[model samples]
Target: MGVQRLKGKIKLISVFIVCLIITVFPVVTHAMRGDCGYEGGISSGEAPNKSSFEYQEVCFITGEPIVFKGTLKIKKTYKNNIINTTYIYNLDNAEKKATLTRTLNYRTEITEKDNGQITEKTYFQKDPYEVIKIDNVTYTLKNYDFTRSSFIDQKPSINFYSGDIWNKKTYQTGGVNSGRSTVTVEATGNFYGYDQYWGSAETQIINYVISSESVKNGKIDKWTGTAKVTLSLTTTKQLKYEENLPEQSSYKGVYMEKQYNESILEYSCKLPEFDSKGVSTDIIKTKSGSLKIETFPQSQPLSVPDISHLRGHWAENDIRILYSLEIFKGDSSIFNPEQYISRAEFVSAIVEAAKEVPKDPAFEKKNTRTAAARKKKEEEVISPFIDVSTKSEYFASINAAYDRGIVSGDGGRFRPNEPITLADALVILVRSVGLEGMAPGKYPVTTFRDNDLIPYYARQAAFVAQEIGLVKGDTRGYLNPNEKLTKARAAALINNFINYMREGIKKVYTEGIVNYN
Candidate 1:
């Protein structure tokens, strides 16, 4: 709390929840010409975590490159079918030229309809807005209304949304009223969350009318301006196992995600001369910076997860890691590591590992609440599979996977009790990671020995999984795509998938920024 307040500008740092890309220097390296990164660890907290970051960007409002620092504090509380998040920012540019203090309060509501996907709508509240000052201009908030909506199945794919915003502001220079602007914005954007890291980018069309202090001939003197705005927000959350902070534990050392949002508003606008009173000129502004904060761990494993039966097993370590991370769980002492995993089990584990599980509805008031407030939550989804009962133990997970597009029922029946085939399992895993789109429309023969045996539906998934190092041939050099997946093999593959997200995907993100030349 104390260290984060020192950052200098509001025009410099912004939100991570509405973020885009994860391109920055690695921690411990010198700040590069066009990048900035941090080297420290996180602090423990009850809810919203706290952290800060620095970056080098072409200033969106100043039209010049500047190094900037910022701090973002975010707190979330769950309430009836919605998660309300509070974003607090303390921003400062490196040169001490600009600063901003603001709080953004927003709520994302998830409504589980009869459809197969989760529909989310985000709403922002207006009140107690802070001032945003950049150099000579001070932007005082007057009114704001913004909303975004999207649908996601439990995968790492992009969260696409279309939104509309109307924001009113009054500006003053040297404490004197300069103008008032009504800014209208339309946008379609998306957030892509890879495991351990996430990003979102938005390019918006904004039009604003700047009204002067006087009116001429019964008309208020105003100038209409339009611009193209692009904001690139980058961040990746990693669990620190090698840090000097809190020691790693099943109940501690897990870290929440961070956000670094850079706003770059650049366009060519020509002001028209009226009565020869204004000079015709082109104006452009490109201010960019990001705000990222790290908070303490908030989630822990459900229980010790009796891995006693996994002793000397090949997938022992993998299973242990997943259990520690709360990504997978097991039954009692009779751990069947070599047994075939059911479709329901595979889908549930895959979704949980991807971290796309939606929250249940908020608790109702003790007193009789309104019907809307008490709308059903425990029964999150009505099973699309005729074979899956609402009372089945796997009902929630199976329904969730269906909603996320991770799995599908055949002829309206989900064979929950049947073993999941390797081909089917690979498809689910590949889909969960959001790389299924890389599969070519005209498929090529796979390089595996059993290429001829690879099922049609699993061909793409096999290709993608193999390319990403998530799959390798067996001792006999066979993919065995048609075989049922054993719990042991499933754990190994799932662990590999997690590693790919933590290390392989990260390699791409980091190396791309450093070697873009």
Candidate 2:
């Protein structure tokens, strides 16, 4: 959003990557938490499949809440929007003398939205498959499921979430549930969990109200909630001195029992949390602890320019944030802070900041000559708009942004060289992050003196940007939406957007979740 860095004053996520968007504005109303539930994770990673897991589990074996310390081995891959994951959990309860390994085959569907939200649909076309091998055989998991749906405002200052999970793992030999274990693993936020074998005959029914809120702080949202759980586990089946130890060693035995726990469902990250204190840290720590996925975004290099011009400018800090991320690559030292930025330049910068990974979308459609489409499409001199050429330095970002519906051209031509207006920039910025049409009304008014100057099409975007603290009018309270955005002004706007994403979004997601609980 801006060109400068925040000097790490706000703690950015070390491994936060590819999160979702929500266009939530209405106050979310979640019913008071009745029964206890569970949720999310965050973890330190050694490799793609290696992660740490530390959480308190309702252990039937111990008849008390037992802390399960272990590593959740995960291998996740994304194709076309579907994510396939393999989870291998090897856990040991030292205090409770419990040990087990559970493997889960999980999948999720990811859909990107323009309204500042991301939706993940689980078990849509796939079934969750799991296998278990318990040497101690204290219990058996007859059922397991979880739901996780997280939403953050565009300002991203608030994280809104509500979810419920149910389980039916029964004891195999202990005194509760006829010696068959009834075990459940529940989670909250944008998804549902079901097991093919466990859920095929009996459905998992959760009872918490489907409450939604935009708790700009809420009265009912909890990042973690408390509930009473009837847990169970089996004491060792007392096997005596056998006449033949050979046959006894080969014999398999199962036992189970039950216990109830009324405790807060908590998950914390063992990784370095954000710089900000309070609930934000707890959220980050927990989200990071999720045993679901791993993201290691490769960093790119940016050229350093002698931009002494940034000194004393209000946009300096924002510009530095972007600069640290290497958003300004091609430009050199004379970086004009007061000059007008072209539409192409603005689009390119937006695309880069969003990390769209510029690619010409048309190439895939245009090169669809072969039936199998086996031929690799090479980057050619193709352009979406008539005026922009492949040779243009801004071509990739422009094309990529256009393909993603972040920008558009007029009359089949992209006026790349033209100066971008304030109104136009607002539209592009809102669209770039899929934040269009999310304001309270179809057409909203701004607090600017010259609000009438904004074109009819750009009014909604202007309102959204203003509401999200992205657009601030001049000292005279004039929106100046129709005016060409000066370099200094553009720097400020860009920086503001960056703050929304990095600081604001991070704040809500990390800390807001803690509060939501």
Candidate 3:
């Protein structure tokens, strides 16, 4: 019995050893696989027992032609105690240059440490690579096309001034001097294809039209001027505000999708002419400069004002006159005043204002000052003659006034709606009926005793108003002749003249010289 028991114990020991080998064998194999195996030429005895991983490099240019071929390794794990291990080697034979570079990383993990639950994952990424072709031509990662070629071919700027272009009307008292000049330049090359490169130009041109005789020492005795410029893609190209450039290219090709620059320039000036009393006066002022304008198309949020009373009050008069003349036709039924007013619209408004105060018959019919008044009014329409070309809508009005002798212009210039002064109006009014011979003492001269402000040339003619009873002096007997004439004042002055003419007709009727209707 003792011999049989010892034999049983030995058998049990053998079984325990066999179980231990089965449980530990896989763990050892897996641990070996986790380590990196060094590779080198070696004898069979030194060679690694397990398969080793191999790596090689592949490269490509961004926008060139080339080919790439490579091998990818893959390994499969066993599951459910089955010997299901598999290995794969992937290779591609397709011929194509790489537009981008990519990097791949792989990882395998035993998620459940208690069990042999092997999981493998892969990741991919790309990076830029420089390439040199077999022809020894180097290419970068980014490429450009024909559209970019056009912009890149342009050269840097070279600025120069252009001569003035003069526009004239008549020779006598109808000429206006215009100093219209320009600046020309070429755009810089390499402006295209740059991911973040942008270009812009800001320019201004100022002008002064002075009396030929007034130029003594580079200074004009009396002068007037105005300025304007072509704007953006409509005229210029490659526009940017006084702001920083963005990272990516915000522009496309020049033809259809490319953006152009904005050019902003302005000018203003006055004229030298006579007042109602025939006094020479200088009237011109200006604020001329340039700006960089940008355009953005986005819906603007509506703003609710705290106070609504001021809504229509701001542009009331301008709106009324503009609407009456059909100058302010709203777009989509909404008036957007912040929008830039066009030159056509501005000129239209001036024509409307002139129409509002048409030449009166009382001023036109009288033989005394009719010819002179007609001449002066005609002159006003013809000054700065550039304003009225045959194609211009203002041509008819300008020519009509010229024919009626309602105005007279400078040498050949017709300054339309440049802003009129009190003296300018008087010059037109005085010539209407030939008031040259009227005496200063006939009317109430006491009313306008203080006529010192009247320019020497116009004093005598101004006194004629007193002589003709057209004006009774204010309490101070003074006339502010030099003050700028307001719209209301101009109207009042016209009414007064009309009344004067009517009184003269009444006197004639009382004497029975003229028959009453």
Candidate 4:
């Protein structure tokens, strides 16, 4: 009987050990999975594990005052040709108090770029009563309203692990009251372990400054400020299993709180002050104080091309304007201002600009006829160029120019890729302005030193272009008609053309028509 009892006890011990292993195996595996190791590789739905606990919390605090400055200028040209200009300047010299409460909702989208960099876009919303104050003025900026959506990019921080430190720079710019302001923020981030009260948490300490200037009419304003901010996030929470609770209800929990204190170290504002006599005066206001902010989790989020190497070029502004209008797109952001432009490119730009021109009834009728002919099945519409295919991207623009008499291809070939000469460009410009037959048959023999070199067929167009200040002679007084036109010259000429169309010769010829003194 004693032997049988001892054997039974051993059997029970074995069973107890087996049951313990079964119960603890999964929990140990889960805990180990949360350890992403020292290496930065993370599996999907892993690492940054916010689901290790029930509730997550986030908080933000500001350390210093936010300084801001702005300027605004407005200019208006009336139909009667009257030009009016106004300038207003504003400088805020006060302790800035602001608090932002954000809940890290989720990673809505992740984009992996060709450069192997991953961009994680997270959506967040601010809590109510986010206060912004500048001295005595409490700005009710709508951007702080709880109903807006806000987002932040987490690319550089995506690979960060516990105890890691990272630095980031951010820039934000926006239009404000006829002016614009730019804010630059520099931040350092400290990563904490996952599964904390705020899972997948990080603390960011930041320093930010703002500078803004604006112009409208004849008024101008300038503003500037500096401040510090602290941002923290606890992205997600893991719910404890409970028999009676709904799964969805358990997973939808988030908490946030924030506090801010800003001391205005230095503050000043320069603005335009008017006296009773309506005379302009400059006024400066300076003050300092302590600003406090309280914040909660936001329910609504608030959310708010570079040209190459054309610096200091004479036609840079013109090129930029044309680019903004989509009339000119240089090869890969390169204006290549000094490079000669091809006939195809020149014609394309001209046609694009013409699209914005006020439609003339006569031109409208011509365009209508052109469109009709293009649609008819029986009308075997012939292309003017044997080289240009209907499938070519520039075909429509070239065809439109041909129909409008803005350009006439040579022979049966458009020679679309050939470098266009100065004389040819002038002829196209002259014809584009509806002055095809208005040029004089004869001009002063001394108008250009190289007059004899001018092609007889292009003399009238050259004369018209020169008379309208659309073309200029070289320093040696030569027309250089046979020379290939450069992109810079083309941009300048196109700018002059647009100006003539808008303001006419009388207003645009402020410094006289001829380049010669």
| lDDT computed for candidate 4 | 0.42
lDDT of each: 0.51, 0.46, 0.30, 0.42
Q: What value does the lDDT take at residue 493 in candidate 1?
A: 82
TM-scores across all candidates? 0.53, 0.57, 0.24, 0.36
Model 2 lDDT on a 0 to 1 scale: 0.46
For candidate 3, the lDDT comes to 0.30
Ten consecutive residues with minimal summed lDDT in candidate 2? 194-203
Which numbered prediction scores highest in TM-score against the true structure?
2
Higher-scoring candidate on lDDT, 1 or 4: 1
TM-score of 4: 0.36
Per-residue lDDT of model 1, residues 10-127, tens digit only: 1222222222233322221110110111101111111221223322222222222333346555555666777676656566664556776667777778787664446777677436
lDDT (Cα, 0-100) at 370 in candidate 1: 58
Model 2: per-residue Cα lDDT over 1-517, one tens digit each: 2212122212211221222332223221111111111212222222211233332333322222345545565555567866666666666667556665666665666676776555654431233333333344445444444433333223112122232333323223234332333333332232221111000000112222111111112222213222222211101101121222365543222112111111223333222132332122233221211122222322223333445566787776555545544665555456777789888888877765654321111112223234344433443244666677766778778767766666666655668888999888888777655555577665677778888888877888898888778877778888888889876677678867765653444333334444544
Ranking of candidates on lDDT, top first: 1, 2, 4, 3
In angstroms, give how far residue 173 of model 4 lies from its true place: 66
Q: Say what the RMSD of model 4 is.
A: 31.6
| Model 3 lDDT per residue over 90-141, tens place | 2222444222222222222223333222232211112222222323222222
